[model samples]
Target: MRSDLCSLLGIEKPIFSAPMGGAAGPDLVASVCNAGAYGVIPLWGKPVDQVAAGIDQIRALTDRRFAVNLNLSFAYEDALEACIQAGVHGVSLFWGMEPSAIARAKAGGLVVMSSVGSVAEGQAAEAAGADIIIAQGWEAGGHVWGQVSTMALVPAMVDAVGVPVVAAGGIADGRGMAAAFMLGASGVWIGTRFLASREATIHPDYLTHVLGASEAQTEWYHDLYDVAWPNAPHRALSNSTARAWRDAGAAPPGQRPNEHEIIGTRPGGDPVVRYQSYTPLPGTTGDVEAMSLWAGQGVALVREVQGAAEIVDEIFDEAMTCLAGGPGKPGPN
Candidate 1:
């Protein structure tokens, strides 16, 4: 059941974990890679020292290939160079990147993948020499690049690009993956499902919200939380902060209530300021419920926490079953 994309990445599965900054830390990435699924860690806005250091940790954990990503919208050039030097198997470029930059990564012998919000963006990425193109939909959690659903965007990008297309957004289970394969996606990039896994370093409260909520509880719109990373539209679970902002008339950036308020702290005690675009991690306290509960529309399907490998195997079995024209179920194929 492997696709060319999996063969290109040398992974047994066609599932690529989303490079969720802050949430998808090195532990989760390494676990997924070791499990035979592609793992991606977001490197943008992180400390330069941590870029290679995180790769070191993953390398120590698993010898398998994995990827790191850069959100050009808030990237540090030096970090990009550092990743190239570290020799990660792949690098995902996002947020309207220049083709020359993708060329630079390719020159370093790094497999280049770019995320696109539109079919035109997919074409541009392919022209820019992206070896793989991730078609990110509006249903994806955290900061979204463009406004299109997976159902419509995947096939369009597949039609638009010559490279392999990876479908993202709203995909939470084997059913979604099978559907994506039918839509011409060479692979599927899953986020929220990984967020519910045991390897994720997010706050327990956040996990609780993900498990307890339904699909309708998740919402995507513009709000103040983007103050830390402005201009990028994101999708997340409806939490207290979202409710307050929504009730307060959904004010624009500058007019939002409690602007710059210090809401919580990082697990290591770093101050979590208002609108910081911070996803609650372990050891975090103070209004954890109010912090960004970023998740995909697939959050509804996320029922419980399991090891990363188990989640991968479960998804693999069900997706294979669906593709084989059988009823999707857990357990064995």
Candidate 2:
């Protein structure tokens, strides 16, 4: 079962814990890597010092391979420097792609993984020196890259790129992992499924909402004119806030609740409510409703909040069983 991806990342399993940015903590990341799966810490919008500190913390916890995610749209330079200085195992860049940044990361002897939306984007990333290219389909949580689904995107990128292809979006279980591998993906990156885990630092209420949500409960808000996310599509739970916006004919940006206001509480013992101001929600403080509840359609499959190590072990075990035949069943002799 060893592919180029497993060899390159030095992981026994082809699963990689996605960099959930503010939600992914050192314990969670370290735990995943310790479980023989790779873990990534999202470094979007954080100060270089903070990023360095976080990386240091993970390093102190585990000697296993791990990655630091760079949101290219923000202050990527500082983030890149932090990764280099901290001696991170690898770097994953999402959103916009920068060839020079990729070169710099690779020059520092760090493995580089880039996320793209389309086959063309995957090719470009490979050309730009990406060691691994993740094809993120529209069904993915957080910010989706392209309008295509994982089924279509995975094979396309595999054909177009020379580097290892990692499939993302709506993949949670071993069944999905087997499908991705069948489609030519060297590995898979999981986000939403891990988000519901006990290691995830999200608010309990938020986790509850995801666990209780049905497949139909999730909606693509980026399709609405009022909720565009630059080049990415976002899949989220349709809540009162989203419905109100849709019902109000998608009010102008200034008129709506600011992200910070929606997820943040006011001073003086005010109840926690959605931000009504213009500022975005501060990074990863667990204001469930205020911040974007980025999740995948696969959320319906998540039933409980288990430890990260337990969850990783279960996913790998289930995937191996499924690949053989079905759970607890043997493959063809």
Q: Name the top lDDT candidate.
A: 1
Model 1 residue 226 lDDT score: 79
Superposed model 1: Cα runs more than 4 Å off:
330-333
- List, residue by residue over 168-249, the lDDT tens digit for candidate 1: 9998899999999999999999999999888888899889999998989988867557757777778888877777887899
Please identify model 2 stretches exceeding 4 Å from their true place.
223-232, 255-263, 266-291, 327-333
Give the backbone clash total of model 1.
0
Task: Report the lDDT tens digits of candidate 2 across residue range 235-295.
Answer: 7777767776777777655565443243454333344445221112233343555435667
Name the candidate that leads on TM-score. 1
Q: Against the true structure, what is each candidate's TM-score? A: 0.96, 0.88
TM-score between candidate 2 and the true structure: 0.88
RMSD of 2: 4.1
